[model samples]
Each structure stands twice: as C-alpha cells, then as structure tokens.
Target: MTPKAARRTVRIAMNGVTGRMGYRQHLVRSLLALREEGGLDLGDGTVLWPEPVLVGRREPALRAIAERHGLAHWSTDLDAVLADDTVEIYFDAQVTSARQESLAKAIAAGKHVYTEKPTSTGLSGALELARLARDAGIKHGVVQDKLFLPGLLKLKRLVDGGFFGRILSVRGEFGYWVFEGDWQSAQRPSWNYRAEDGGGIVVDMFPHWEYVLHELFGRVTSVQALATTHVPQRWDEGGKPYDATADDAAYGIFQLEGGAVAQINSSWAVRVHRDELVEFQVDGTEGSAVAGLRTCRAQHRAATPKPVWNPDLPATESFREQWQEVPDNTAFDNGFKAQWELFLRHVALDTPYRWDLLAGARGVQLAELGLRSSAEGRRIEVPEIAL
Candidate 1:
C-alpha cells in the first residue's frame, strides 16, 4: 500500500514577475509547474508546496499574468505584502541595481530569501545583503542554475570518476550575433546594451563563468579581460535609436587556483559555430571533453588518432568525428525548477543548501574584478571575499 503524503504550503512573495526572466523562468517554468505537479516529495513522506504571490510595479501586467496562471494573489504594493504574516519567503528577479535594496527590505521583514544572480551591481552591495540576511536569521539562497544543467552534471560525473586526469585547460565559447534592431527586430531587450541600465557582457556573463569555473575545476585566482562595445547604437522596441554604452563582448583569461587555465569569450556580436549557444571544452591528460547545453562528447587519450601536419595536402581526416558521444544514462530535470525545489525544501525542511548570498557575492566579485582588469588593461588578482 502507498503511504499518505504530508504537505505544507510555502507562501512566497515574488517581485519583478512581469520581467522576461521573472515571468518565463521563475514563474512559468518553475513556480507554476511545481504548483501543478502537487509538491516536491521529501524522501520520507512530507512535501513542500509552493505558493507564489506575483508582485510588480505594473498592476495590469501582474493581474494578467496571475489571472492567466490561475494564481489567487498578486500585488503592486510590496510594503503591504511584506507586512503580511502569511508571506514566509521573498524572491527577487529584479534588475541588478534594485536587487540589494529590495532583498534587504525582505530580510528586515523576517522573510526567507531566494534571488536571481549577480545579486547586486557591486561586490560590496552583494556582501552587505548577504551579511544582512545572516544577521536577520532567515534562510537565504541565490540561483546557480547553470550548475544544474544536464550537460554540466554529466561533466561533473566524469570529473568525479577521474575520466579526465590532470586537467590542463578549459575553453568556453558562448554567444550569438544579436541583431542591432535597425533593419530587424532585436532578439534581446534594448536595456542589455546600456551600461547605465546595468548591461554588459562582463557583468552579465562573467558571473556565470565564475561559478562554472569554480565548481568544475577550481576557484579563479586571477583574471585578464578585454571588453568591447561592438554595437554603439541600436534601435529600441519603439524604433527609437539609442546609444549602447555597455560592452557587448568580453575576452577573458583566468588562472584557476588548481593551476588550470580557462579562457572564455562571451559576446552578443559574434556568430556561434559550436553545437549549442554555449559550449565548454576541457582538455586533460587522460581525456578531453566538450559539453554544450544538453550534449556532451569526449575522446580518451587511447582513442585519439594521430594527425600529421600537412597543410599542402588535401585534408581527409575528420577531426570532429574522432570524438565519441557520451551516453545519457540518466534523466535530467529543468534547471530552474530543480533549484526552486531545493530552495523551497531548504526553507521548509531546514535542508542544507549551499548556494547562498555569499556565493552570489563571489559572482559579483568576479564581475567587479573582470571589469577592473579590462579598465586597467592588466591581470587582476581575485581576493577571496568574506562576509
């Protein structure tokens, strides 16, 4: 006979639900789906149910989204929501500049916090928020969604099993050509190209790279970065031209604490030639592997074919085909939802959650250092941040 499930609802005040990442990822993909699937099973019998109240500045958009998703609650006034006793958790996906202030408010209101990454515009701000959360004695977590990606998980498995011995280096290629919005509709929001609006490839993508590099190989010890604003002017959604003050591309080289070198090129101006929108290649002594969003391929030293340098002769060797595909032996869940479930469990069950504001601060630290490196035109040391 099946056992009965014990369930408890967690009321979460979700701010910035009207934005793109907020709506699609945190709301549609994660919270609503969790609500629809009943609740997460807690290994034993107890289950944690997610109850999200959409909060935003725009009442009409919030009401529409809430009504469409069959949500019972939404509010334009955050103060009123914070004062309510029912809201046990507060989540934010707001712009970088606004994150620290709102999250600080939530912590002061005695609510557990979960937020999207690059927690704040600066390391100090991020660290202050982390310190506040700790001082308030509330559970806190930051989204590190990329670590949960299926491809990265598989790569982690390989690393754990010693598939790649004595890892030498990592090469990450990410991005696609974003249309300048003059002749065609821009794929990304116009705010992404404006520095004043908290836009730039280094600030946007370096945080992700920081975590990925730290988790996969080791923590970054030093960084050398060069940033560029490829498209200086672009048309907005309303067909109005605007100056893009942020850097659209960043070329960075990092020295890992474990002595592994990692080079990453992040851009909105370059066309991709890889298998996915983003890809990472890890070269080691025993084997080499390449991982994308959902696919992973590897070649062991024994399987590697010898190739002689002969540019004069017609190249017949299929270098790409020499590598064998890694098997998908297990199923993977949606990254955003997985992290959400973990955060909910952390709040409800007192689970051990690792990705806290401190980790988020580290992400901000890397972005700060990367920007400094670019501005100074020299390699910058990454000092460990403590809160």
Candidate 2:
C-alpha cells in the first residue's frame, strides 16, 4: 500500500445493521466487504478506508455481525454511536419511517450521513433531513445503486459516447412476488407490508428509478401513476394476519425534462418471466439497448429492422435478435459495496459525489408526486428542489 493510503481511515457507525437491507446490503455486503478487501482507489493517490462499527436492533444480532465481520465494536444505542468521537460517519439503513428521526439525531451529532433510498417517506421529512444535513455541514449521500451496476454502467457509457443518438424513451420492469408471511413463512420483513412502516413500491423503488432515469436520461417533469395493494392481508412478525395498508405495486409514466418519456412498473406481486428480476429497455434515435442485472445488449439503427405486428405473426421475430450483447468489461461486485466505496472517498478526500441528499429529496419529490397523482386522479408536475 502507498504511504498516503495508509494514513487515511474513515470510521463508520452503521445504524440498523440487523435489518434486511441494513445487515446484508449496508453492513456485511458493503462496508464490511470494503474493510475485508483492503480499500478502493478514487483517483490521484487517494484511497477509501472503511472501518465499520455495527449498530442494530438486538444486541445478540449486532454482536454476531461484529464477530462474523471481525469488527471490534457493536452498539445497540444510536445515541452512543452518534456521540462516539471515533465514528466520523453515521450510515442509516433503518426503516423508512424511522429514517427522519435517526438522521435528525445523527446530523445533530455533527457526523457525515449516508443512507438507503427514499430518504424518508414524505417530501416534508426528506426536505427537513436535507436542511439538517446542510446546516450540519456534513457530507451526505443516498444509495443510487442502479447507476453503479455493471450492466447499467455500460449503458451509461454508450449514452455518454453518443452510441445512442438522441435519446427517445426508457422502459423499466422491476419486481417479483414476495411470498406472504403466513403461507411461506415470510420472504420479506413484516414491516414491508405496513404503511406505518413506510412500506410501498412507490416509496421504496421510485427513488432508485429516479436516480437511474436522471442519470441516463433527464430530470422528470411530470408523472402519472396507478398504484394498488394486491395483497390485502399479510402475516406480521407474530404470524397474525394484518391488513396490508401499503401498495404492493405501482405503474408510472414520466415526462422528462426533454420531450423524452419513460414508463416504469414496480411490483411485489408479479412473476419473473425474463432474463433477470429487473430489466430496462432504452431506445434512442440512433440505437437501442436492453439492460438486465447481469447483461446488456446494444442495437444500432442501421442493423435494426421494422416488423409487422399481426396476431397471426410469430412472436419470436419482434424482440429476439434486435440487439447484440455487449461484453462485460469490469469485474463485478455488490452494487451497494461499490457505492459505499464512493461515499467513503467522498468523505475522506472531498471527491465530487453527485448522489447527495438533494438528489435524494428529488426522489422523495417524485414519489410524493406519484402518490399525489394517484390520489388526485390526474397527472402531477414534479417540482424541483433546490440542491
């Protein structure tokens, strides 16, 4: 290791480390992986140094996580973690409804903050968090994991290189059936079915899509959406049936800043019948591409063809061979881990990270607009938030 690399270390306090996304994605998968992997290079001679000190719901779970990851510190008290001088950064993977309160406390403690998407359940809370972070003068970021995915990264390269002439529109299909807690012993957490816990596709997934769309295309101007709860009753943690107050699915159409339009379907009640769990098809005037979790394909207009759509016509010709698979050019790792490295670098070296709290608030704005559109039964224009 370089002498300079050895000098810098970023101490992180992970909040909600025992939860699903918290434990798997934020702690073990992202921060711990970085710690085990040594470090990540940002540019120049700077490298990100991640040191995780786990904080979670249960003491036993937190201890197990710490021991398993070879981390020395574990805490059940959020206040103590915030007060610890060694913890320079406070990372939140807490439930959506709890994020605002936790973030407010963390910011008050004068620590840099990073958290999972949707920052908070509503625009007001998200805006408040943004204001608090700004006032605290600490670095803040939200996970925009899709932008860092290898397949999507390749697509971004194509777009930036003008491989796709003038972008037209994007279509995204995201989701799969999450088993009911009672019948299958619960695939997802019970909190995910309760509205009070901030559980819903529109709130959870749109933040991710907003970043992806904004990164690949342009800003969203307006949105029209339809949302529903397919499963009315779901089992809770106690194995008792509770009303599923949150939406299980959301279908939305967005008008981007430019004339380009996009549509996205997010659901927890759908079956996967495609290449991957989530897939996106991006079409531009010059070419088109289809990107999945594991693969990406590009199509040039010159090599593409028009086909007649007839009920009697074979379904195979339309989409089967329209695009060519783009070879994977980078080593693969967890997307959350990749973003974690970036955030660490941003904190340690003042790296130019664009995925800040303002961007996160924009996502909350879209989700709020989607809910408003669904509620009012009319298309709603998304208002811009000052970054």
Candidate 3:
C-alpha cells in the first residue's frame, strides 16, 4: 500500500479583505477556492495547505468574512498578527496609499509577502520596498494576474509559436463607464476619483499596461501620454457632489525596445462598445491577434482580406467575421487563483517566480513617468531599475 502524503499547513495573514477586489477575488475566488480544492500538492511527499487568517481594520467585516468562509481566525490588530510566529505569509490587498506601510511592516516582521499593485504610491517607495524585501531574504511577489488569463495565455502561445513574426504595433483599449454617484452609486470606491487619495487613471492603469506590454512584446523604452480629468465633478457615496481631481482618462503611446509601437487608452468615463471591457490587438508581419480577458481571435497573412479604397462605394466586407477564434487547447483556472497557487508554491518549494517587487516597481515607475510626461507635455524615457 502507498503511504499517504503528509499535509503541511501554511498560515497566511490576509489584510484588507473588506475591499471589493480583496473580498471577491483574493479571499473568495482565490484563497477559499484553493482551500476547497484540498490545497496544493507539492509533487513530493507533502501537500501544502493554506490556512487564512482574515485581518482588516473593520472588526465586523472581518468577523463576517470569517463566519461566511468557516475560517476560524480573524484579527483587527495588525501588530499582534505580525507577532504570531506561526503565520508564514502576509498577503495584502489594501489600497495603494496604505499598501507600502503595511508591506514594510510585514517585511520587518520577517514574513513572506504578496501584494497587489501599484506596490507603492511612487516609484521611490516601491523601489525601497523591493530593497527591503531583498535585504530581509523573504519570498515576495506582486499580483500580475493578466499574464495568467486565458486570452493572454493564448496570445503568448501565438508569440512563442512565432505566429506573429516581427510584431509591428499593438493597440489596447481598457475601460467601462463607471457610474457617477449622483443617480446611482459609483461602481468604484469614492476614493478612486480623488487625486489626494492616490487616485488617477494614469496611476491606476499604467502599471497594468507596463507589465502587459513589457512581458508580451518588449521592454517599454519611452512614453508620450496625455492625462485628463474627464469628469471634473462627481457625486460621492453620501449623495454629495465632489470635484474629481484625478485623471479619469489617459491616452498613451509607448515605444518598445524592439522598435514596435504600442498605444493604449485607459478611461473611466468611456462607454463600452467593444466585445470585451479590455482588448489588445497585436499586428505583426506574419499574423495579427486580438485578445481580451477571456477570448483571443487571430488572422494570418494568408487569410488577410484586401479591400478597394473607394470613398463612393459602401463598405461590403465583414471585417469582424474575417478573424478566426483561437481555440483553448487546455483548461484555464481563475487568473488570480492561479497566481495565488504559484506564489504559495514559491514559498514552500522556492520555485522560480519572476513577478517580484522589482517588477512591480517597474510598473510604478511607468505610471510615474507617464504622469510626468503628461505634466511636462513631452516624451519620457524609461530607465532600467536595479535593486
């Protein structure tokens, strides 16, 4: 008879579970779902189990989540939780403003840290965090969930297969109309519109674009951006009007290291007209692909359509139908959950994980430079960051 695999539980102290992203994606979909799936098997003689200890500022919210998930641990005191030697990992999903300080404390406590981006409010702080983590010799990671998405995965597969030979340009559109709180409650928190609260489209989305463009195509070499506050006045959660001090929309053009150009528009004020809320169209010499959060469509040079340029004639070609849908050769798990598992494995097995604090710092650097570009009305060059 085969011997049973030994189970080792890893206690993770999760902070900011009360936030929308934290509650839905991290707590419920990722961690709890992993718990339900019998944790992660290390492929050795051990199974790594995750034990979540919910920590938040609000006692009621933490207690509620613990009760809902049947979790036995809940704490409002962060220092006390950090002092607990049993807790091996500290996962933070807090807002950008609070993230740096909390992560710093966690690092100081000598705990493995994982967090959402932008890791800090500015590039300097982010670099400092990376430096601190390196000095502490603790396993640290940032959530780069898009890389694990099915659409992006398929797009990556195409890139690896050399389908898009000598990629020329990439275009991306990401946003949806976030309702102003006047008639209906805002979809996002009230703080997202206030610049003082570390809210702005450039700060919020450029970090995302940084990782995506860099990982798939090449390193971003330079950036030219125009950031604007489209909705200057907005209603708060209390049905009171407030000035939207942050940029609600950003139009950016980035030059990649390999000579490819990438353009992306991030907005909170735009209405949805595309098939997906977010989509990227990559054009190459050999082929082209359009990838969204869950779907990817492609068109090869062989199947390229030719249309006559006659302004007098009505359009006849069904351009949307010309592209073929990319097939999913394998099942894909939830991106956030997939990342969580990988980070967990990295903690347990010292597996190769690239999306560390430095990568996250690069994202923050992009956002900072993008904002600076907009402010100075000139292109800003991206410099390599070293910890």
Q: Report each candidate's C-alpha RMSD, comma-separated, in the order given.
A: 1.1, 2.0, 0.8
Q: Per-residue lDDT tens digits of candidate 3, residues 2-33? A: 89989999999999999999989998999889
Tens-place lDDT digits, model 1, residues 179-203: 9999999998898899999989888
Which 10 residues in a row give candidate 1 its minimum summed lDDT?
39-48
By the lDDT metric, which is better: model 1 or model 3? 3
Best by lDDT: 3
Model 1: lDDT equals 0.91
Candidate 1 — which residues are off by over 4 angstroms?
A: none
lDDT of each: 0.91, 0.85, 0.94
Q: Going through the candidates in order, what is the number of backbone clashes in each?
A: 0, 0, 0
TM-score winner between candidates 1 and 3:
3
Evaluate residue 8 in candidate 3 and report its C-alpha lDDT on the 0 to 100 scale: 95
Q: What TM-score, to 2 decimals, does candidate 1 have?
A: 0.98
TM-scores across all candidates? 0.98, 0.94, 0.99
- What ranking of all candidate models by TM-score puts the best one first? 3, 1, 2
